[model samples]
Target: MRFGSIRVRLTAWYLMMLALGLGVFGVGSWFAMRASVFHAIEEELADRIRDVKTFLQDQTPFRSKIDIRDELSEHSVLGLGGDLFQICDEQGGWLYRSSALESGLVPIRLPSQVGDQPVYENLTVRGAPVRFATARVVIEGHPYTIQVAEPLEEFYEALERFGLMLWISVPLLLIGAGLGGYLISRRALKPVDLITTAAESISINNLADRLEVPKTSDELQRLSETLNRMLSRLDISVQKMSQLTADASHELRAPVSLIRTTAELAVHEARTNTEYHGDMMQILAEAERTSRLIDSLLLLARADAGEGGLQHELTDVSTSIREAMEQGWSLAAGKRIELTANLNSNPIVVRGDGEALRRLSFILIENAIKYTPEGGRVHVRLEGSHAVVTIEVTDSGIGIVESDQPHIFDRFWRADKVRSRSIGGAGLGLSIARWIVDQHHGSIEVQSQPGQGSTFTVKIPLAEIPAPLGQP
Candidate 1:
């Protein structure tokens, strides 16, 4: 985070990369250019040697003193940028030198070899670097040393000029690279910068704020879509919490107000034993109802806090349904509702906490029994797919309204508000049941009509089975 803004970091990285690449390119160019300059110099030296050899060969047939001097002076300018040449006798004494030289031929060492042998040397001749080639030969059976040399100052001057030009151009090249890199990074990261600015503008005051993306489908678009999804989830969570807070305040205040007002009424009527006893019964009942509501609220809160850890194992759905029916038999019997099961007694396998599932099954069947009219039927069944077990409970009851069905599993929600609480429920049964199913990675769906009945289906994936016998 201390590395400065995105644009600066991007520009810096681009500049560094471009500088490295260009620096390498410049080094290669410098070396290659220097080699080319040297090659040109070498080619010129070879030409000078060839020209001297030709002149010596032609003058060997008949020696000419003035003619050779004239011919040497004539070609002097064409020789390797004013090359100098001198001829020597067998005794190593200079006979002739190029006219370009101010002084006479100088004494130079000659290699003591019999046949024609070329010797090369670099020396400061006439206050300038020069390459000299010498060859000893016999013309008309007389030994002679033929020497040829060329000035190296022009080549040196060209090299110095190249080095100076490179020195001057390097800074300008780096500056151009830096500028180009900054422009490229800016263009590449413009979309990301736009996304950052847009995100900064969003607020809780405007949860609906969205990224204004162009039609281009790129990584930036994908990033914007992902951020929007997270925002949507946050918005939904906020709405749920707000609604819960309002509903809790409304529900709790009414019961507390009733209790307080009832106690004040009871305080005024303690004159006779009969009046006191009657008032005490009313107070106790209302207090019990309030206590039950608080207990239901606490249970729902525990479930929401994910505290009801499942004691999971493989449990048979048919057996679980039978257990639920037995647990709620008295409640169904009191209402004269016949609780029955359409069960496949086969091993309907499940991998979950048997206790939690049993409790969930009881809650669904209990709801059915409580809501169903007298003599109405509640049926529980165990069904199967290839790799799952399903427990379904259907009942003939005063079914939930379609509008309220969506939120029936929400805590403390009751379709029949006036009737449901009196039936030993603070309306958290479906919520707890749904949470239990979720813990098992199972799902539950409810189908109902206003006057007909309700069907609650629970689906749990099957556990793996060991190798089986043919018909067992």
Candidate 2:
């Protein structure tokens, strides 16, 4: 019932408009009725004057005023009342005066400009309002002015009754209308209230819970559906964040525990300089691994937050692949693997961040070298198609199972956990490579089979070559 509520405001506006319309209609009707009553009274007076003229014409050639008076008295007996009727000749001599006129209750007044048209006027006679009509008529070369009057008390009473009815009924009608309007508004907004209640019941603990979508194809239904969709997205994001937190905790724990254990062992025992140096190297290696994991996590976080920080420029795909191969040569050599590259005679140019592209190539080559056995072959190839440049890194190594290929790019996910851990692989390299490829608007995919090998292919859009300065 608050005044500021939509329901109350709607009802108030409805009532205001209704009141205005009814007021205008009432005033118009009252004026029209009053005019009609006055017109009817005027017509009655004119008709009476016409009747008198007709009667006087029929009784022509009156020899005396007494004869005219006797005829008028006979006319009165015939239901034409003579109390307010009067007549006069051209010389202002009274021909037939009713008793009401002669008794001075109603005065006799001749029109100054007597004409064929009737002259109507309102008069007060005996302290009562009356309507009079006067007209002149010429009969048998004699002119006569006849006047007729009618009282207005009954007409005024009728108007008062109508006015009273309007005054009393209008407010009652408005009250009923206002009540109806308020009820209708409340019924229409009931759905919104239900939605509000349902929405309030949902929280972080119940993110998976969704609002019921109404079947009424209206704004309320749309609102419910949109809110449900938003809830679904929230649910997905929360689940992903929870998974990331658990995985991050598990990954960081191993390296930190190792570093702590190594330091404690070194401190608790006396050791030679050589032993100390070895312990320090082991500690440094664990520390370095932990730092790498943190950096990968931060990079993925920024990527998820839509901050890729890529400085895009034209980069040579062939050159980046060669650089990554050179970086991976030492590892391949240590493993007795044959590292080689197949590059196009001409450089294949693509649009991307040079450093990110180089890192992408390095991750793929390093992953191949790590998984490949000694005496295995690792190959890098850079090729250009009509619209894109493709980098493919192939290796002859312990390949992935079909089931695990789909999740290889997921953070902290490794197909062979023991092998991955033994080789200092945190499994974040492929995930970071995927992010870098996505930032360059490129696509990366892998084809692998157990006991055969793995091939990682990356495709980036070729950069448009600028024409010479004057060319269009």
Candidate 3:
């Protein structure tokens, strides 16, 4: 009766279908029985009419009318047990009547032009149901009408019993069917209840808990699997968020503490101008470092939020590579490290944002110079074909260990935290570079061995060739 529940609605639909099927069956059964019963009655009446006609034809021709009448009387007396016979002239003058008729002068409807072919009808005789057949016969060229009737009491009694049974059994069958449908619906929807309970029990703290998958490979099973996968992803994201918060707090605290300590020292004592100027310079340096870190963090935040997409254009990637190498030459000179660039002759045209590509180029070259020691060598190479462009930056520096290679591009990640801090970095350059390369539909890969060297390679798709002039 609760229409909102799927179980109840399903059961209702099942019972409605059952009711329709049973109703059709019941009606067909009733009609079939009625036809069978009437056919038997009509056949019986036909047989009786044929027998009476033959009897009349066999009478002697020499007998007087009274003798014939006596013969008819004897014939009528012989017929009994629900059978009745009537003999009359075509003028409706009765010659004989059977004991089955309660009155001798009973009027029965008859066809206006009776023939040898018998006709059957259902009638009422003295308020009792009867089936009768009428036939016209010729005896010595004299026409007579004969009628044979049988009481329908037994046939009607059987029909009434069948009808009563149908009325009684149909409701009982429907009730049993309704109950069966409800039970089946309830069993089928039990999994939905389990899923609801599991969902209700889960919270942010218990997101690792998953719904129990059923054994059957059905829609419900797929649903449970999908939900479990979603929960797994959420758990990973939450862990990353917590780690980023902790790392950001630590990085920010260092610079802020330094700036505050230097300012406090300068104010606490009357120092010489030289000492005061040194404190001011140190404070300015820490402030600038903090500002750069914050900027990098904000840039990454915007990228993650899908703020800016790559502004694609036909760009020569070799130009950016040469520029980045030139920039690195200065930094490498200060560190006493050798810098090298091997640029290809042909232009490596790619579809990407020019500024983003330039930034990507600088980050890789700079990262190599920062990590490599004095007297080490850094190599930058640009090579291209018709289909793809490749950029490789190799350095004979303190290489990353295999364990730390996978997480190198993660935000705030550092393989050697102390060394990275001493070298002045917030660990966001490589992450941002990776993001830009990805935006351009490219890939960046790194290969390194501890204490030997490191190589970073980038591959980007080439732009399409332009059509020749006047070839529309």
Candidate 4:
């Protein structure tokens, strides 16, 4: 039982207890039956002895020992089955014997020193088992002994039957007990087995499994709920990481492509001062774009790695717009496009980093100038209110598709692929512009349709008013 598992141990203990009870009951019953049988036989023997002694005292004066022996023999034959009686002298010599035993079946070597010292014994006499008791007597100034012997077959038969019953019933009880123990153990462990099965069915990649728990509000049910919650968090975090990776790759593609194209074009050139200057400028332009793209990517990486957002100050929207127009003037004029600025007269201030806000405005104006056809108009406006300030760039150009407008702020996104290729710059303007604006608690949006010029609006909270207008 100790060597096996819990079920086996429990079964063994129960069976052993049953076996012990049966053994004790069988032994007790055997002894009880033997005692009862011996007590009844001895009681009968004692009664008969009293009767025979009384008759002997009442005998006539002419009665002899032989006559008395004949009388005892007759009584012994009448009281048959398991009793025997005999009369003997004090010197241990027999005078009369019962008819229950033949001459060769009597016990030999009777006790000589008998004075009520429990002269009773069980022994096989000649070929049969017997229980004998002896007592001393004095008659006519001489000593004599009386012995009583009983056959043991009745007692032996009763004990033997009890033992047989015990042997038969014990095995059957053990079988029943074994089956009962197995059923109980299985019922008790059913919950554990179910939990194990649930765990085994779940996959690491698809960790959407759940236990079929009972509504008892048990520990097992709580465990299942906790595991499900953990899986939900894991799925969310994995999705976010996947999105970040995809966005980074998309953002990196444009600059890499621009650098590749510029290098290729510079290499496939002939010697001429103007051509060489153009090639060098093109290469420098692409190099600077690549460098700025890389810088923006690094900033995003830092933010994702728990770094804080951009450093900010109270900056004027008009100043940023005017600077952006100046920088983008050449590009706008190169396409014969008209650039107009409707900036506020007062110092219209918003909370932002000056350099970042200026870059954002430049990106928007550049987009407007690049897409507008000859003689097209591009309007840049800066407006301020107590709540927020807005820098808006509106262009008369090959406008964005409504479908493409939704993704215009995405990294490396180009509304018109062929136009973007001819422009010779990475299509990261709107993406970086949006990033910078977002860092300053600002929002950028696009409103456009196919062949209907686009407008880019940027709004930021007026966290602090600008100082009185000052020249840069």
lDDT at position 405, candidate 1: 89
How do the residues 177-206 of candidate 1 rate in per-residue lDDT, one tens digit apiece? 777766776777778888889999988867
The C-alpha stretches of model 2 lying farther than 4 A from their native spots are 35-152, 212-217, 307-362, 374-399, 433-444, 455-472
Q: What is the lDDT of residue 162 in candidate 4?
A: 76
Itemize residue pairs with steric clashes in candidate 1.
312-353
Query: What local lDDT does model 1 show for residue 390?
Result: 81
Q: Count the backbone clashes (under 3 Å) in each candidate.
A: 1, 0, 0, 1
Candidate 2 vs candidate 3: which has greater TM-score? 3
lDDT of 2 by residue, 243-332 (tens): 888898898999999999999989999999999999999999999999988988888888877897888788887787777878998999
Give the clashing pairs for model 2.
Answer: none
How many residue pairs of model 4 clash at the backbone? Answer: 1
Better of 2 and 3 by lDDT: 2
Runs off by more than 4 Å, candidate 4: 1-282, 306-309, 464-472
Sequence-dependent TM-score of model 4: 0.46
lDDT of 4: 0.71
| Ten contiguous residues with the weakest lDDT in model 3 | 104-113
Scanning candidate 2 in windows of ten residues, the lowest lDDT window is 104-113
In order of appearance, the predictions have TM-scores of 0.81, 0.77, 0.81, 0.46
Q: lDDT values of the candidates?
A: 0.75, 0.86, 0.83, 0.71
| Reference-based TM-score, model 1 | 0.81
* Better candidate number, 1 or 2, judged by TM-score: 1
lDDT of 4 by residue, 1-472 (tens): 3346656676678778877887788778777877888787677655555555455555524578788677666655676222477766655566677655547466534435566433567868666677776665555555556666777777777778877877887778778877887678666556667777876886656665555665547775777677667777766666655665776576567667766776677678555788778777877776776677677667656655656356677777778777888998898888889898998789877777777788889989988888888889999988877688888899988898777777887655676667676675446677678778778787899887557698998988887544577843
